[model samples]
Target: MVTATADFVVPDELLAHEPPEARGVPRDAVRMLVSTPSAQRHQLFRDLPTVLRPGDLLVVNTSATLPAAVPTLDGHVIHFSTCRADGTWLVEPRLAGRAGAPTVGPLDTAVAGQRFALRGGGSVTLLSPYSQGRLWVAALSFDDVPGYLSRHGSPIRYSYVPRSWPLSAYQTVFATEPGSAEMPSAGRPFTDRIVTRLVSAGVQVAPIVLHTGVASAEGHERPYPEWFSVPASTARAVASAQRVIAVGTTVVRALETTGGAAGSGWTDLVVTPERGVRVVDGLLTGFHEPHASHLDLLAAVAGPGLVSTSYAAALAAGYRWHEFGDVNLLLSEHDVREV
Candidate 1:
């Protein structure tokens, strides 16, 4: 309903179809554009570990990408989350069709716990089903969303990242959450080694879960609406840490959600300038397009000109867009001057 378009237009060549041949030496090895409430600075992604000090806590979304969308036979698409799978899973089912009168639908050709029987003997199964047809609230499990996607499903895909990639490639080095369709791409370059180094360097690390649906692009230009929750430990870490650096927009939303006046709930909180930000001190994220709701959240916290200027720099410098590309790291002016 809140349909809109990005203010800036990305050149066809700027879109990244895949990551570098190998994950970079430092997951954060890519170039980083540093923005703050005060001024602008340019740096590399690897410089991130050093940019912030020991007391600065890095908050990462441990939410895993969920491979919940699968095609059905009768035109009824079954969308579900994979909980567990030994070739079987509890899945949330959705009849992705006209939200009205149903003709035969895809039910006739749909099988609950078995593969749809592709052209060959190959098959995919919606192993588990929810209490009803509620995909969002369903407690569905599958052998493995990751495993199945490797075999049949695509990267909890969307038009943004524009190409099918192995699920492993889609994940961030610190990925532990198994419910995101797409990896928190901003964190994609943060490989295990980088994370280890950050830990050794005294940068505190904490996890929050946010099961991201697909990319925000598919949701009619709406803000990324994800299922997120902060653990007590994470909550505590955030409250006590001298600095909180969100790994990506998703983590930002999750962390900010917990800090809100209402506290926490099943948040469909679409962060915007009006809603404003509370907990995040700095952010490491992909360069979102102009007018993106995520950008609004950025503006809410980082200021409109700040994000806009940083984005312009990112674009001018030929920084890649989407997951599988370079990154932008923003620190608060208050911290920038201190460092």
Candidate 2:
């Protein structure tokens, strides 16, 4: 197993409190830190088309965000993580604050068969422990999960964001399938204009589907297995591309799991510096927490040295952090040739 330690401290000020659109900044106008083997450069996200070669393939996730957080009568919030093949769900229960923000709740005291009443006339019974007791295997009383969520659920909110935002704010232009618990945030910055420019510049863009689960705010927790699908056309595009640039860690996980093949299933593959990567040549992702596991994937693609240097630059430049923050484009020197 590959593990990562927290290498630096992220100041509280760097956290983005709201989306750029709320602050009068266009989504595509957000700052971008471009890191290559030779140098690091500061640019706007709108300049993405100029940063890549014509034949470079940009792989993006097409999973849309779901309003997965439902409030319980006991003042706890249930975050629906993922659905199992057997039809049960993996969920995390968090304490709801007075202002409606959520914090990590006690999972140790939760017992199997314990049931919590939902606000909208349903209940969830805890079936077993999942992910080493960090989450629970839950069986919802409602038969239509999506329909129930649409009527009673809101987008999951953490303490950083003081108020709730609409579901539209959590979606990307490429979203076609609805299943992800959270947004594939790296693609959040891409607008119709930028995609048009990229296509006009001959940068091929393809879609992969990866339904992301709820993010673990705890320390050093490895990512759980999530659902993904790589279509035949995307696989072919990846195999023949001059370079494959993944738009997020989710895309990297999907592509690396399939190794440029067309397939669909759950992926538990975690990209680490030791394991490295085979299908991805570059990555465009949002800034992560100092100790986030996503950093390991970035290091695997671009090397630890480049990842460290680029992060330091981003910190020094006062770049924002989190889903609604600035972005980093890491162009790796070690392409598929090394594989």
Candidate 3:
């Protein structure tokens, strides 16, 4: 057996910062390479529905991405940026989160001890701009915090991403609730049109809420604890489905967190071979960094061979990594799912 360690090396060029310009297609359109745990093979994303027979079920996380990055008078600040079960985003930042109240000028002009009145007079004290651009965590009153932000805040955005895309672009077609730091980008390619096609073609879609904090790509600390709820109906639907096609890692995490382990609320359930997985028949996820903790989870589910083959194919084929990049897919050869 090959011992696995979270120690793989990754090339920086593999990272993606923008979505593909094409539309009316499966969000899973990014270069997809299919392989097995023991042997590598080739497959296409469009063949996804065809790969499954009648009893297979498809499970997906629908936790919508929030506009966690907000523009204050100073510039743009980010927050809750907790990563969901998937390696995608649902950025939900608090006004007083790391960045303090924004100043009236550029981030360079803002410094410690500076105070600014928020949209609702919820005053804040500037702490630091270590983030470089325009982010600072400040002290503020708790009054109407969410309300104030909803009114004055635009989604948090980073400069490197270029072209301020709307909050909608960061989500899957089945998005629900506002809990993610950013959208689970692997699901982004799943527009309404694609969902219709998949459903009509005998695919089952289910939704769950795993309020993701931020993108780990931001290079922050381990995800702050986020909440996950699996209603009885959704649980039954997933348990009964023939195949579980997870939209991204978040959905996989949420479903696995529920099966076998009987708990709810904030879960720090990081997936590895030790923990293993009980749910999710297949995965529709973005290419991830080599040796990433998220990679551990995927390898656990897809197995090293399937993961390695698929990922190897993705890399060789130039699939992008991260929320805005293309996607990768994995399916069991044995007929485990029902159509």
Candidate 4:
């Protein structure tokens, strides 16, 4: 089963440069595109609880977003992607902007064993290149890693974001563990009101932890191993669920890594068309970049045809894209849908 390919021209205007709040709208006010095997429709995100039926379970990622980008005095920033059990971190160095945003670049001047001072009295020593010369294995020296980072580090930003936003804007309502480098953006549309509506509608919300790595990668690059945890209770809930709806790609990857068991570990599970998902009956996720490896995971759930059609409809409807963008709910046609 080869991965399906499609061409999409995302207009520059469709890019979500800031949160919905900045645009004078609530978080749940974003649009949602619902795609099944036979049909597709557009709806508001706040209507999700009404759309899903009773006994359905929504699996969410509780891994919190980290202010991982640490700027240095030398005009460079170190992005903390993932941490190893041995206390080493997988990091990337990029050119620092005047306003604290990062422009992706190679650390051409970085050498193993070289130490550089950070802006807020910490230091990082390069150990070696990790993958394709874009990431590094570095050791950090700080009194309190979390505290120091809170004072100095900023959320990782890409060129699509016009300016820097607060770290709170990158977080979701379900975020609990502070480990992920980037937001589990699919869950961002859920608000307290949405959660209440879901519970009142008899939908169960389960949480799993997957500390995400850097998301800004070249088109062909696959995701690296990231730390994940699936508790026994969540696994049991998944087993008994009438429909298991994964809230994000991170949740799908973490649940699949469990293999019907429950524990914590690192996973490099790249969901593709050939390697279809087993534990998820559906998925609620945000719009992704074209030709990105994430599109393969979406293809696995919705199939290539539905994936392509849904994206076209979303684009035509003026939906936003990226972390702060609109959402897509891909479900099986045979499920017991309500709306």
Could you estimate the TM-score for every candidate? 0.73, 0.94, 0.73, 0.94
**Which predicted model would earn the best lDDT?**
2
Candidate 2 lDDT over residue span 28-73, tens digit each: 9999988877778899999888887689999999999999998888
C-alpha lDDT of candidate 2 relative to the true structure: 0.86
lDDT of each: 0.62, 0.86, 0.59, 0.85
lDDT of 1 by residue, 181-283 (tens): 6577777777677888888878998887777654433223433245676878777877778888888888878877778222333456766767767888878
Which of candidates 3 and 4 is the stronger one according to lDDT? Answer: 4
**TM-score (C-alpha) between model 2 and the true structure:** 0.94
Residue 293, model 1, lDDT: 60
Worst 10 residues of 1 by lDDT: 100-109
Distance (Å) between predicted and true CA of 198, model 1?
1.8
Q: Model 1: runs farther than 4 Å from truth?
A: 1-6, 22-26, 68-151, 158-163, 218-225, 260-265, 334-339
lDDT of 1 at 283: 85
lDDT by residue (tens digit), candidate 3, 15-63? 6655665333445555555544444444545556655555555666677
Worst 10 residues of 3 by lDDT: 88-97
Candidate 4 per-residue C-alpha lDDT over 205-250 given as tens digits, one digit per residue, 9 for 90 to 100? 9899999988855677656889999999998998889889999999
